[model samples]
Target: MKNNFFYGYSKQADLPEKKRLLFTEFMKNNVKINQADSATLLTGVLAPPAAMAAKKAGESLPQLKMIKNVPDVLFVPSATVVALITVRFSKRLFMRN
Candidate 1:
């Protein structure tokens, strides 16, 4: 029942044999950031801002100028969704072994 914070497990014996082996294997492996993961992280970080900028640019065109309050109408909810996605992605990205 001991809490081993250093190794991130409560007790080795409490874990099932299969899980214990998997945990040990995971701990033994070297943790390196995957390039694809880095790319996904970068895209997540940049996407919202890039979308906003593009939306603004599109709004500035004469034909597109008829639409007003696009930020309030579109970007607000989209930004919220993007923010939520980024938060979730960041948690996964940072928690990866």
Candidate 2:
């Protein structure tokens, strides 16, 4: 339907079954990454239902690999707690500069 978020993609035909899927797509592929406006840079969003339905219909879609959370994450986070990440570089690398 014209109102569908993926109307244009759905209308495409004669494409390789694998390439016809709508998963991750660039927002502005023609724009150079380094030169394009940061605000209009490429982006993509998930349409899981669409992909799943396509797979059920026997269309060959790119295999989606789902990442399961660490098995060690058995304990649920507290309401007031937030997960944090830290990146540490080698002391030798910074010292050389």
Candidate 3:
């Protein structure tokens, strides 16, 4: 159990059920986003399985709303892919000047 990825969370049986469910739901929804360092700053590192357990326990996790992609020229080479990406860069450029 100690070796589990969510050992700390699993051991948190003393936590209030509502708070625990929220944490778990947060994890389940943001698991992929939290993989990035920047995303971690925004989201957090939570345990998805813990959230699943909460769901199984009859707690409903609210839908997690996360941006589909972060508009960075480095990751998105083509500015045409998303007009927002171009707009974002333009805003930055204008601000810098």
Candidate 4:
């Protein structure tokens, strides 16, 4: 029960690195920010590389999307933690900008 709850919660803050990379890459190629227009709002888990790329490209991503990132019993602990932090901090930075 606890594990399930944590898994659900974590999905809101983290995503698989490959998915993050692809989502941000797609946005980078498609989103354009103009001063007169409000920036597009995206909610998704963003890894460090994806966030940095989006930042440099002037894209706005608000938070981690509620995407599934299932944690294996013994394999995904550390990566999940890092991804959570990356997504949160990146969202903060994007919001600030």
TM-scores, one per candidate: 0.35, 0.19, 0.26, 0.25
Please state the error at residue 38 of candidate 1 in Å: 1.9
Model 3 misplaced stretches (Cα beyond 4 Å): 1-7, 13-80
C-alpha RMSD values across all candidates? 11.0, 20.8, 21.2, 22.0
Per-residue lDDT of 1-97 in model 3, one digit per residue for the tens?
2334365566766787855786777678668752333423222223233333433443332452222233333323332333344445665688799
How far residue 68's Cα lies from its native spot in candidate 3, in Å, is 29
* CA-lDDT, candidates in order: 0.66, 0.33, 0.45, 0.47
How do the residues 1-97 of candidate 1 rate in per-residue lDDT, one tens digit apiece?
Answer: 7544446544555668856776766666746654555555676667677777767777888887855556555775586577667766777888895
Error of 4 at 81 (Å): 0.4
Please give the lDDT score for candidate 2.
0.33
Candidate 4 lDDT score relative to the true structure = 0.47
**For candidate 1, what is the total of clashing residue pairs?**
0
Model 4 stretches astray by more than 4 angstroms = 1-75
Candidate 4 lDDT by residue in tens digits, 6-80: 444456465577556655666787789853212222222333345445344443333533212322332244444
Ranking by lDDT: 1, 4, 3, 2
Winning model by lDDT: 1
Q: Return model 2's CA RMSD, one decimal.
A: 20.8
Q: Candidate 3: minimum summed lDDT over ten consecutive residues — where?
A: 39-48
Best-fitting candidate, measured by TM-score? 1
Least accurate stretch of 10 residues (summed lDDT) in model 1? 3-12
